[model samples]
Target: MTAGSNSISPIPVAPVGLSSRAQRFVEVDGIRVPRQDFRRHRDGWIERGIPVAEIDRAADFQDRWGGLALPPAPFYEGGPRILNAGCPKGSGAEGWSFPAGAGRVSMPYGFMIGPDGAFGIDAHRWTPLHAGTDGWVESLALAAHATRWARTVTRIRGRAVTSLDLGGYEPVPEVQGVTDTWWRGEDSLIALYRGEAVGLDAPQCLEAHVYEGLDEWGLHGG
Candidate 1:
């Protein structure tokens, strides 16, 4: 589905759970179905060691959670994987939208699709050691990587954020044509580029701002 399309599956009626390893599973009626084991790939994760029972479980899970089934090859590089959810709240009914609903399994980094259709991540838990620097450079690298991957999977181009409405934003002078904006949290920062904005917890990021809606960008990494 495109960025604003309602082609998203409705929230599942069954109980959804995330494993300690960040695996998303389903518990319906009374049966508990676990997700396949994930192995680390080049800066990403791929499912492996899936048992036959898990296949049956996946089928059942799909049946319960709108007819949306998991991808034949469940590979998550970054960003929130859209499995069975609706368009994000507030976005119009026209284009493809990343509606926040059930069946979204975010990476350990807390990448999620905000209600406004902007791609976001909860980097509040990250530390400077994650990138071996003070984290400003690391945050930019992560934002770029996540944006590229999010575009690849969802076909939804992220809206570039050119400026910020509050403080704590530092421009990346090296990367021309893209102005980055960040909202400082207690420990970390939530970032975006021109034409982008955070959805929930606006106060945590910015107290006052305008919502220009989500805009499309050219193919990232192009």
Candidate 2:
């Protein structure tokens, strides 16, 4: 759907592989695009001289999709809250950081685009959430997609999570990250851990939510 001069269009059905029930689009520059698209709102990054190269790298996907407005899941509230580009902390040798959003509590940490073109959380240190912003977006999309089709969602916590034998599950490449990860099996999907644990330097906070009873369509929506 498109947006007019005065009125924003109603959110259209999410793209085929995304979850329609999980997210709605937000208006950007009077154009209705997915909330994940941060293109038009990236002026702050440019003004800060955040290296065109770095901005371009993150924009590869941010231009097309913005962050998701997902339901409460793990450490985040309303998913990764999308924000305007800003260098809350001045750019350093590590490179310029554009504040993306924050966790549910909004304290100690928030998301950002780090120097090496990675999308990560900034707290005690920069903890990479994904190799790139595109990965983060893909991760959210997958989560919503899987949850929508899963018959049962089982959330597990603590040491028990690390013990799950994912013998038949394959890692989901789109949602690539060390601490937080997604795995897919024949009839189920496993979302392991949340980045907040690592970002906040609290390993004990790890958790996993399993989505079971998903068919091929659910696993990989068209």
Estimated TM-score for each candidate = 0.19, 0.70
Rate residue 217 of model 1 by lDDT. Answer: 26
Candidate 2, which segments miss by more than 4 Å at Cα? 1-9, 12-74, 88-92, 102-105
lDDT of 1 at 64: 34
- lDDT tens digits by residue: candidate 1, 136-205: 2233333443333332222212322233344543432222212233333322233443222232222233
- Predictions in order: lDDT: 0.28, 0.61
Give the Cα-based TM-score of candidate 2 against the true structure: 0.70
Query: What's the C-alpha lDDT at position 31 in model 1?
Result: 23
User: 47-148, model 2: which lDDT tens digit per residue?
Assistant: 866566666655543433433233444445544544323433445666666666555565667777776667777878888878766566566667667777
Q: Clashing residue pairs in candidate 2, if any?
A: 35-66, 36-65, 36-66, 36-67, 37-65, 37-66
Residue 185's lDDT in candidate 2: 93
The model with the greatest TM-score is 2
- Best-fitting candidate, measured by lDDT? 2
Tell me how candidate 2 scores on lDDT. 0.61
Where's the lowest-lDDT run of ten residues in candidate 1? 125-134
